[model samples]
Each structure stands twice: as C-alpha cells, then as structure tokens.
Target: MTDEAALNALREAARLSPENLPLRRHLADQLLASGNLSQAETEYQAALGLSPGDHGIAIGLAEALVRQGKNEAALTALDPLLAMPEHPVRAGVLAAQAMLPVNRMAAAHWYRYSVARDPSQADPELAHRLGIGQPSAPPPSSTSPSPIPSGPAGLPAQPPSPAPAAPTQQPSPAPAQQPSLIPTAHSPSVVPAPHAQPQAAGGPYGSADVEPTAEVEHSPVTFADVAGMDTVKEALRMKLLLPTQQPELFAAYGKRAGGGVLLYGPPGAGKTHLARAAAGELGAAFVNVGLADILDMWTGSSERNLRATFAMARRNRPCVLFFDEVDALAARRSDMRQAHSRQIVNQFLAELDGVDEHANEGVLVLAATNAPWYIDAAFRRPGRFDQMVFVPPPDTVARAAMLSLMCRDKPQAKMDFDKVARATEGFVGADLKGLVDRAVEAKLHESIRAGRPIPLATGDLMTAAKTMRPTAVREWLGTARNYVLHANESGAWDELLPWLRDLR
Candidate 1:
C-alpha cells in the first residue's frame, strides 16, 4: 500500500476502535508523518486520556503543540507528566518545561537531574543548545564504580543495610582523586593550606560555604555565532584584546593599573553573549561563575567557592571569568542582615580588587547585571570595574540586522524591514529572535495543515509581532534612565558618565 493508504488505514482503525489507546497512538504517529499536526495532537490527546501514564504520548502531544506555535499549551500539557512519580526520563520532561519559560536556573537543575539519572546522557550538545554546560566527562558508572579511600591503610568500604526504596535517589559516592597530568606554573607545595576555622551557621544569607567538589560545566561559545552588538564587541576587543596583543605597552602602565570591565543593561540585551564572544575571540578559556553556582547549603562554602573561582581563573590565565548576574551575589547589605551574606559580598569585593596590577595575567573579568544599583558600592569603585558600559535596547538598525539573521534560512515572502523595525521599537535582541521563531512556527504549521511548502508571508510576521509585546516595560526603562542621569550629574563615574548621557 502507498504511504497515504497506510495513514488512512491507521486513521480508520483509530476511528473504529476509539477505546484502543495503541491504535490512537499509531494514528497520531501517522498524522504526524503526514504533517497534519492538529489532527495528530487530537489523536495524541485521546491516547493520553486512555493511558494517562504514557510518557511517550505526553511528549508527542507536547511537541505537536509546540509545532503549532502554542508553547504555552505545550507547557500545560507537560505539567501533569512532570508531576508523575519515578519515571526514568522525568528529568528530560522537566528540562523541556524549563526551556518553555526560558528559566535558566530551573533548566540547569533539570539538566543536572537528567544527567544524574542517566549518566550516558551527559553529552555537551544539549547543554550548549540550552545555553548551559555539561561536564567534560560522563559520571562514573554505578555497576563498576571507582573505589573511594577509606583511611590511611586503604581499607575496603562496607555496604549499608537495605531500606525502603524511594523514587528520588541520593548521589553516588564521590570519585577518587586522580593524579594531575598537566603541569602548572605555581607549585603545589607553595599553595596556601585550607583554612581550619569553624564555619558559621547557615542563616538568611544562605550557606556561606561552597563545596570544593561542586563544579558547573559551561559550553563554550564562539564569536562567529553572536548575531549583533558590533559596538560592544569592538569595545571588548580594545579593552581586553589590545593589551594581550601588545604586552610591552601594557607593562609600561606598571602594577597599579589594569582592572575589570562591567556590562550593565536590561536583561536579554546579549551581555552574556558578548562575554562569551570575547572569550572565543581572544582564545581564552571561558569560565561562567554565576550567583546560583556559588550559593551553597553549607556555612562557608560560598566564600570558599569564590576563592576557588578566582584561583582557577588566575591559574588558567588568558581566561575570561564571566559573572552573569553580579547584583545578586554582591548586593548592598544592611547592617541588620545575617553575617553570611555580608561575608560573601566582602569576599567578592576583595577578589575584584586583588587582580595583579602589573603582572598582565591575561585574566579578563566580565560582570553583567540588570540591577547595577543593587550592587555594593565597593564593587563599583574605580579600582574594581575600571570601565562600565551600558548595553541598551537595540535601535532600528540593529533590530533589522537581528531579524535578517534570524530569518536567514526560512522561506519568507516580501517583508517590510522598516515596518518590522518600527513595530519592535523597545524589543531587545532576544525578543526579536523570539518573534522570528514564532512567525516561522506559525508558517510551518499552516503549511502542514494545507499540505503545502513552508513559506512565511508578511501577514504571518505581522501577526507574530502583534502577539509578542515588548518584554521591557516603559516604567522600568524610565527608572534605569533616571539612575543613569543621577550618576552622570554626580560625576562619580567619569568614564561611564559620558556614555550614559549618549545612551539616554
């Protein structure tokens, strides 16, 4: 039989036997193959009603809705699946859910969970696509686990008594320490001893202690992939690249100079992307240490983590240490707050000021935060962030560039670039990309329903623009602008004040 005949047979069987969930599922598969996503979604939902525990049906239905440009609907469909108890791929479902909302923290948790559950899934590609990182190596296998040291005599470990099984599993035993294969400039003998002070009790500042074993994997991003932000790119090249390329000139300034750069702006303005691009351009190792990465559940781990992060950055010279959300980590602390938060903030302040002035260690620190005002005053002083740049919302020229890049491969009908740019006055880079994605999805869905080629018309784009409002609010922009104005008038930041005026 032809492919169409087989699909027709499946549909007829499903219609004749509505009670058979397998038949319904098969019908849904056939519909999907024929690009009839609406019908496929209906059939998948029917199958789900019959077999509520079927994760396959749930995923299929959610994906169908996603293809139909209904991401919210897809998220709703997955909510019940996420609440299920003890599924092997539950982590995968949770990750998908986080992606729908673009919640990076939640997504990172789910990605980690997914990898922990199935060690074989610890590939870097998925994490890179999600704008996170995966560990370079797969976690040790449970069947043939690595042996942990018991004592000085290397005693064999004892097995624990069995208990009632639970759905959520505890982490595996810590892997044994391996010998270092690479040589380092600093000798291990000269390294400072781990402090023996008693850690403070956990309080409102959360755990101040960060575990030495805790490490986050970040997928490296290259400069070629970043879409726009030419001005920001050029500024980073001048500030970071020029010094390294010409070290003799850099040395002339001596030890008292060379500080970090701060990129402050509204969220989704590509600050993180710019940091990654600079790292890639300069051939430097990219280390992303965010506030969430450092916050530990123990009393002194956060501070220790901060120290470890800086040490690692220094050791791995020609590196870029990116703090994506600095305000959360270095917030101005009130005297009444618990001691832990204040300690972490102070540790950050010290690290920011401790970069070697004359060594030209080739360590470039790039910190980004939407709420710059919330950061502690010490971190913003001249010696810490020598240069601060404001990354504003894209203007018409940049918006057009972003749209063109987003629609590069899509089959588009005649589009009015001017109208689209004008319509997206306050939209950030990410917002414009989302608009393009929505329009492409709508066009694909329509084409599938009509059994035609995927071709996006101007109307489809216009409809997408109407549905996606500017994510940034006018009130928020006004507040930020006012803060910039106040700072400029105060003359507190001589270098950044001029840029602030121009931005406004």
Candidate 2:
C-alpha cells in the first residue's frame, strides 16, 4: 500500500481500538516519522499513561521529547525509568547526550559512567564531539573496573580518591602515587585550591599551558549567520572586516588590520557568539580563552601562561583571541586582595601593551564581560580595548529574526513572528530561545489533550512570553544604571547612557 493509505489505516485502527496499546504506539511512531511531533507527543504520552512502568514506552516518549528539541523535558520523562536498574544504560546514554551541550565535561563523566556499566554501549562520537577522547596509548590490563568518580556540576574537580583495594589481587604500588603528584589540571581540579593557594596552574589537560594544547578552531559562522544587530555588524565591519578588505585604504591612514574591542553587555546577549562571528567574517582562527585556562595557583605561571596565549595568537596572525568573562581575570587590581590577582592584571596590561607597546598588530583582542565596570582601566588605553561595544538585548528586528532562526529546524506552525517579537521587547537571543521552548512545551500539552497535531501558534508563544522575563538585561541594567549615573568619570560609559536612558 501507498504511504498515505498506511497512515490512514493506522489512524483508523488506533481510533477504532482505543484500548489497544500497540496500535496507539504504532500510530505515535508513524506520526513521529512524518514530523507530526505534536500528535506524536500525544500518542506517546497516552501510551505512557496507560502503561506507566513500561520502559520501552517511556523511552519512546523521551525520544519524542528529544526529537522536538525538549531535551530538559526528555530528562524529566526519563527520570522515573532511570531509577529502575533493569536497563539504565539507555537512560544513562540519553542523559549523557542531553548534557553534552550544557555541560560537556560532566557529559564525559556520564559517558564514562554508562561505558563502565557496559563498555559496548560507549559512543566515540560523543567523546569526539566533546573533545575528550582516549589517549593514544592503550590502558594497562586490570581485573577490576574503576568506579566513575562523581563531581559537582559544570567542571568536575574531584579530590583525589584513594584506589579501592581489590581483594582478589594485590594493588600496584606506583599507580597510587600518580594522583597526588599530578596537580589535576584538566581533570576537574578546575575549582581553585581552597583559599586560592599558589599551586602550579596548568592547561585543562593537567599539563602546563606554556606550549598550550592545540585547540585552534576555524569558525564557519560569519556575521551573515548572526541575526539582527545591524549596528553591531556595521561597527565590526569598520573596526575590523573593512580594514582587512581594504588594507591599502586603511594603511594610507596609518591604520592596522587589527585592534581591540570590548563587548560589554548583559550575560546571554550573544557577546561570545558575536566574537566567533567576527572571527568567521574575518576568516581568522578563533582561540577562546577562559578563566580556567589562564588562572594558575603558581605565582608566575599565570603571567607566563597569559603571555604564551598572546604569543600564540600573534604567531597565528589574524587570530581572534576571544576572552570570555574578562572581568573575572582582568578585574580592578585595587579591589583584588591576592597578590597573584594583581600580578595577573599587570601581566594582562603588559601583554596588551606588548613589546615596546605594538605587539598586537594583526591579532584582534576581543574580551567580553557582563560587568564592564569591573574591568581594569589601564587596559582601556587607546591602542588597547578602546572600542567598547554595548551589546544590549535584541531590539525588535533581532527578536523576530532570532525567533525564525531558532525555530527553523523544528516543526513550527503558523507563528506570528512580528507579534512574538513585539511581545518580547527586552528579551535577548537566549531569552527568545527560552520563549520558543516554553511555547513548545505548552503546545505539546495541548496536543496531548487534543489527541492531534496542534502547530505552535502565536497565542502559545505570547502566553509563554507573558510569564517570562529577560534574564540578564534587567539585572545588568539595574547594576549598569548606577555606573551610568555615578561613574561616568572618563565618559567610558558614555555610549551606555543613551541605551540606559531609553529604558527609562
């Protein structure tokens, strides 16, 4: 029979045999295959409600949630099944997959957990995606399996656990000494030593960052891929892209191909992504620097590490050194109590100053911080990060475009983009994403009740928007308004005043 005929027959069978669980599940599977997520979710929910303890049904429902991009919701659905010890490998695998984007290091731990339970269930792709693959050398044969050491969220910084003695065999003497000797750099000893002691800081891989790990990424995402922000794009074009495009024109005016830009905004305002886009548009290598990579407990290593990063960026030439959470590392030295913090700040300024104050010629130094007010003043000197770009929440145009971009892959119904945009005034790109996810959740419920596909509509989005608020913008503005009012000393916050005033 043709595909249409089969679907019709299944629907008829499901409707006629409302009591038949297999038919309902079959119908749900068919709907899922046809991209009818709303109805598929309904069928799965119904099947699950009928047979609450059925792991297969629960897995189906979780898979449906995942396919609809409700990963968190899928976790909620899988939680009950996870408690059962029967076939938790499936739940563990799915949870690990879901956690990858949110917390990659933690996901690696989960993958290890699942793999330990059943080595055959391991997924190399997941590890490869997270950049946490096995070392080239093979592991030494051991009769006993190692327990997966659990840690807190985000970065796993487990304190050294003494090896459990294997009753069946004598423990190797040498392997016991390895954990204490190694400073546990990349292995989640990420949280600094208590009281922030002066231990040797190293790269994420538990090795010195002096030579640094080879982690240069070529971003394919350009300014064109970024939604909205015409003003931001234009400023970047003039500051970086256009100069590179018309080198002679810039050279005639004694302008170099690169300089520095400080993207100061509320958190989740896409500062980091915009940095990537800038690198992509410039066709340069992107080297993302975080606090973990730079801060070492050892006194001079932090400075050395900081210099090495700049040196690497310079050698790469035409590289975008994007520093996330710049305020944390480059915070005002006076506010800092630790000598190391102050020294790191000094090193940061010196590196920005470079050899005889002209090192960062071809390198673009872009640092993003939610609290630009906390950034050191010396770093803002003309040749340094003079171009402070104020990235506010998405304006109307951006919100609309962001809505379209975020929901492009998902099966969306007739969504009024303009209406949604209007409803979400102060919402940033991430907030807009939340709005859509909330709407998807609401729509999923409605479909479950109606027992049919109900496309995501404007009303559903608007309803979700009414209950939601922009996360960082309101809070950031609350703090930023004070700076605008009191600390406009050098008029560094001059650009922020207009945007702040508009809110009032």
Candidate 3:
C-alpha cells in the first residue's frame, strides 16, 4: 500500500476501534502532528482510559491541559511521574512543574538537581529567569594560616608559630586571646554526629519520638439496626452464617473452600447492609476498602495501599474485607490502561490467593459493586470471588416488610402494605426507605400548613410514590440478568447460583 493509503487505513482502524489503546495512541500522535489538537486530546483521553498510566498519553493530556490554560491541572497530572523513582519523562515533568507558580520551591530544587545530574539539560536563559546557575567555590585566602601544636596531654593545645610568622606581621598586638584550634560539638565533621546514629527502640525511620494517634475501633453494624430485608437476612443466615458457624460440617462435605462472595446489583439495594450483617453473623472484623481511600496521586502508592489493606486484614484474622464500589478499583484488566492499576489488580489477586481457608478461619472477602459487568473476569474465577450474588431489587414481600418497618412508629390509618408493595415493583431497600421518609416529610408539611399535628395517612404515602421513581429500571435489570446468567453458565459461582436464581 502507498504511504497515504497506509495512513488512511491506520486512521480508519483507530476511528473504528477507539477502545484499542495502541491504535488510539497512533492516531493521537498523527492528529497531534497534523495540528488537530482537539481530536488528538480526545484520542489521548481514550487511550488513557484503557491504560491509565501510559506516559505518552499522560504527557499528551498534560500538554493539552496546559494549552487550555489549565497549568495547575497539567502539573497535577505530572505529580505521579514525579513520585516514580525513574520516570522516563523526568525532564518534561520537571519542565511542567517549573511552569506552575505554586510549585516554585520544589521545581527550583528539581531543576538544580537535574542540571547537576546532567549539565547538558541546563539552559542559561531559563536558569537566569529561575535564579538558578552553576554554584562557584569560594576563593582561597592569601594570608598564611598558623599550625597547631600538640600538648603532652595528646590534645592540640596551641597553634605552632609559623617560623615566628615574619615578626613584622605579629608585631601588631599579638591577638588578645588566641582563638582555640579545637572544634565545638556542633561543628561539621568527617565522621557522623553522635545524634545522627540510629537509635534502638525507635521506629526504623526515626519516627518513634512522635506518638501515634489513638486508634478508633470500628463497631460492626448489626442486622437489628438494618430496618428490613427479611429475605436477604435469611439468605445470609443459610449461605454465610451456617458455613461460618459449622465449618467442620462444611469441610466434611468438601465445601470448605468455595472462595469469596461478591454482592452486585443496583445502588442502594441493601448490598452493603447485607454484607455488614454477614460480618456480624460471622463475628468477623469488618474492613471497608473504598476505592477513594486506596487511590493516591503518587505512582505505586495505590498498589502499596492495596498491599497494606490486605496485610491489615491478615493481621486481623477472622475479618471481612468489604471492598465497596469494587468495580472502580477492580475493573476488567482488558479495559485497564495504566501500569499502576495493573499492579494494584495483581497485588489484590495475590492477596486473595494467599488467604488460607484453614488459616483464615472466619475471614471472608465481601465485595459489592453496582456495576458488576465492569468487574475483571480473572477475579470471577472459581477460587477468587467465585460466589457472585445478585442482590436484586426487593420483591413484593420485601417491599411490604420494608414499608411496615419504616411506618411502624408513624400514625398510619390502616394502610394496606400489600397494595403498597404491588405499587413499588422495582423498588430497592433504599428506595423504599426514601419513599417512607418523603411521605413523612410531606405529611409534616401539610400539618404545618394547616397549623395542626402531623397525621400521616396512606394517602400521603401514595402521594409520595407519585413523586418518587424507582432507581432501578428495565435496562439495569436486563444487564444484571445477563451477568447472572453468564456466571451461572460458567460455573464460576455454582455454590451461590441456586440462591442467586431464587432472588431473580
């Protein structure tokens, strides 16, 4: 093919398959070369979405941000590169940092260090502007210095006369009190200072002197406080509580190592509540690992945080590491673009594998993701999060239970919960709770308007329902059904499949 035709074909490939990182990167480079900054920025962002830590994509995005007068944002993007010990784009990153007004001190230090490391990088004009330049050594003094004499004590007692020091110079009133030749404790020395030596009984980094803050122990939320979800409660008892309480029986039955469980469904479906209840039932220490908590601006910090989280869980045996919004951190590896994300996923996988069934004892991993489809396939294997539980929206029975729990303390004039349940076909636990709250609020509003005591009635709830829409719709349910079906067929979560199907 001709060069022009090949270029056209490459562009077509990129446009047709934007999800492909390599193709996107190539097209982005081509667009940039052609001065199509807008298109190039989009392509770069697409590439980044696939591989978050791509240096080329990161640099491209940073440059785009700078061109848009978002210099601070550009610098923010380069912060991760700075944290990396040997980032390839160090020069470009330093240049970006130098451009930011708030990072002057750090930028100046980096520029000086970089120039010292490689003089070729030094730019006289830029150095002059930044008030940085090659440092000059001090010149030697012309006057001759006197030598010290050793005493019988073996210590330097007095300065030896420099052959009478040319009598003429000394004639000027022999300095009143000769300065001592001995150095003070604070003086610089070839040897390390006494205080500089490492101390025992201290933290390795010398942080022992600083007292740590008192740790606030987390209290697990119990099922009693969770207003409703009888079906969910029962499921937890049979599937989780029974297994945990009678491990000997489970082991004898050859079901001791079924792996972890994943609770996935629409948001606010009581997934977290069910997970907490399971933790309480198992009497396990609850560890909530949120994506926001693990993500850091520095490269490798995310992976480090992941390791630390697992280590903490291992240390606190019989613990439940509840990863909330798990998809944000554990999305499909095929969709991952950044090295940092890959490292984090790999560390997570390793830790998951390291959890010994016998050693872990009561320890369990409960991850909940609203977007289950986004979860990495590797994580869904038989030995990992093999039990994928679909915590679907409450059925009529669950809705009735929720309604009764919500309006128990309120004044309801013989409300038919069955009718209300039928009305809320697609409602999740949270949606039901919200409906009750809104009804109560509306009743209160009406009472205040009429200058009377709040008298909540069935009519008020019906009115609230008209204003409130169920959060989960047909499309969400369809997506969830597909995921559940896929998991069932793959035998990835056969242990939990029967219960999951019953929920559907």
- Model 2 backbone overlap count: 5
Query: How high is the lDDT of residue 401 in model 3?
Result: 74
lDDT of 2 by residue, 1-504 (tens): 987788889888888888799899888888888888888889989888788888777777777777777876776676555433233666666766766666566556555545555566667877688676532211234333332232442232332233455787654211110111112222232224322222222212224446643257899999877898778878778777888888999989988867888898888889988999999998998999877667654335566678778989988878888899998878887785444456678888888878964588778889999999888888888988888888878889888888888878766778789888998888888888888899888888888999987777778888999999877787788789999889888888887776776665
Residue-wise C-alpha lDDT for candidate 1, range 1-504, written one tens digit per residue: 998888888888877889987789888987877889999999998998999878788888877876787755665565444433233354353334435345444444445545555666664655675666553333443322333332212211222122333467644443322111011121111112132222323221223533433243343566566656677777787676877787778668753222588898777888888888788887777788755457643334567778778777776677788898887777786631334556678888888767455433567878998877777777778767767777767888878777776776778777676678888878887888899889888788888999988667667777889998888635446656666667656554453444345444
Global lDDT for candidate 1?
A: 0.63
Clash total of candidate 3: 7
- Each candidate structure's TM-score, on Cα atoms with residue i matched to residue i, is 0.54, 0.58, 0.59
TM-score, ranked from best to worst: 3, 2, 1
Clashing pairs in 1: 208-300, 208-301, 208-302, 209-299, 209-300, 209-301, 209-302, 210-301, 210-302, 255-358
RMSD of each candidate relative to the true structure = 24.1, 25.3, 16.5
**Candidate 3 lDDT tens digits, 157-221:** 22222233365554211111111111112111111112211221311112222211111124466
lDDT value for model 2? 0.71
Off by over 4 Å in 2: 1-209, 356-358, 444-454, 502-504
Q: Tell me how far candidate 1 lies from the true structure as C-alpha RMSD in angstroms.
A: 24.1
